[model samples]
Target: MFLERYHSIQDNKVLISARQGSLFAKEVAGDFNPIHNPDERRFCVPGDLLFALLVAHFGLSRKMTFHFRSLLGDSVPLTFREDDDGMIRVYDDRDKVYIEVEREGESTRDQSIIEHLIRSYVAESGKNFPHTLKPLMESQGVMFNPDRPMIMYQSMNLSLTTLDAPEPELELGQATLVPDGKRGNVTLDYRLMSRGKEAGLVSKKLVVSGLRDYDPNTMDAVVEQFYRLKEKAWD
Candidate 1:
């Protein structure tokens, strides 16, 4: 599987290196979040990578919800366990849960379907920063602190009407942001389509911290720096 190179399985435990996490964030998901930088002091593996790994391991169910508990660091040994009640947990040796998954209905292990959904969803997710979140923040007259902007994935829920699509694509639907003082919650809704037919719906939630009054010029500069980092990494 394509995900094998991004993570390693040893003795029933999964391990992800800093380099591997960084590569998957930048190269595969097109996510340029500074937290995913290998050399950064606050480096953390991208939550999307963990979500992908879960699907890769357990297969995609008709309905699934993923809740992120903690930030995963590089080289952490993780154990994935599924209970009889359809709850899947990914924890470390210390038994600190990093992610919790709830799955229901039928599932499929078809590689083509899984790969297509993973790529499309992550690609759409990678555009969350300037593409989706920017306008949503602007609408609320709020923006993340330019110097120390922080956006954390909270949870994602997926409900599929059918999983028969061989190659489904994810499309952005309605997105909303609700602010409370200095913090804000963002909900991104997406539509899953295959051959022009609706197959599923997905909702992803994120928490933005240190929000301030929206300043277009500052936000633009911040976005520019983000692209510059991506370019530097690619070069």
Candidate 2:
């Protein structure tokens, strides 16, 4: 899996490097968040990377909720342990938990199904800044700082009434932005699609801080820069 390349499995613990996390964010998730930059002072691993890893290792669950408690730095070793009650925790050597996950219902080890879900969800999420956030911010009369944008992934939850199908996809649902001074909370509601029907719904939250008045020129440059980075990677 592409995820394994970003984190090393050693002694039953997964170790992530700055370079690996940065690449995964930009290349795989198409997320250009500055905090994920390898050279950033406060560089941190992408929650999407951790989410992909969890599904890759533990398989996809019908109903799952993931809560991120802390930011994980480069070269940090994480241990994922599953309890008897089906609770999962990603922690450090100090046992300080970074992520807590609770899964219920049936699970599937089908790699194809899992990979599709990961790709679709991340692609849908990567569209947040431009396709989703632009209109959202306009409605609220607030936007992110174009020069030094900061969007933090808080947590995500998904629930499915039943997982009786094999194919899984993601459909964008309602999105709302709540303003709190210079920071805004972005809640994206989406659904899991299977066999041309709604299989589950997912609610993902993000924190956008350091907001400012909308500037079309700067935001245009920012959007262009993101695609340029992704395109260069493909080259």
Candidate 3:
């Protein structure tokens, strides 16, 4: 229900306007990536928004994996399809796929449970930049290009031991970055906590391109600029 304003369905096709996507990125997920800015030339909907929409529409499965195939631009008319085997695909009218999902095991359509998980996951995800990735990059002696930071959501997997928790929260666990030359793969592991007990786990994979030798001074400026943008947006 919270996602209603972020997207629209007409003629069985979904359309997400740039403003809608931007609001969801900043207001909901707390992600201030420039690419999600409405006026940016490279504006695109946040991948986490799409992930949240899937769970909201199809319910939360015990095991689910989302593989992002392409960047979804604003106002794209997309369609969703689910196969008998529990594979879901989100694609544009051109038939170009943006995300593919595979789900298994039990599921729940409980709105409270879904909303809680969505909020908790995105809140933790919004901290990936300075909180998680910065230290990981520093330890690995690498950092994304300062001028043109290119970090993309590649895929994410979710596994739940049960679907009984109505207000489960996500806590960040171990995070790792594996670098291969100019490209780096980032994996963020998270735990689902219900009433102080572990309920399940989730992992998000990201691809960072144009990585170069880490420079503390350069990175510091980048981080500062990021916070500045966030402040300006809220102002």
Candidate 1 local Cα displacement, residue 42, angstroms: 0.7
**Candidate 3: global Cα-lDDT?**
0.91
Q: Give the TM-score of each candidate.
A: 0.96, 0.89, 0.96
Can you write out model 2's per-residue Cα lDDT over 48-80, one digit (the tens) per residue? 888888988898888899888888999888898
- Cα distance off (Å), candidate 3, residue 165: 1.7
lDDT tens string, model 3, 143-227?
9989788789999999999998756788888889999999999999998998899999999999999999999999999999889
How should the candidates be ordered by TM-score, best one leading?
3, 1, 2
Runs with alpha carbons beyond 4 Å of true place in candidate 3: none
lDDT value, candidate 1, whole model: 0.91
lDDT per model, in order?
A: 0.91, 0.84, 0.91
User: Where does candidate 2 clash, by residue pair?
Assistant: none
Tens digit of per-residue lDDT, candidate 1, span 87-131: 999989989999999988999998778888899888888899888
Clash tally, candidates in order: 0, 0, 0
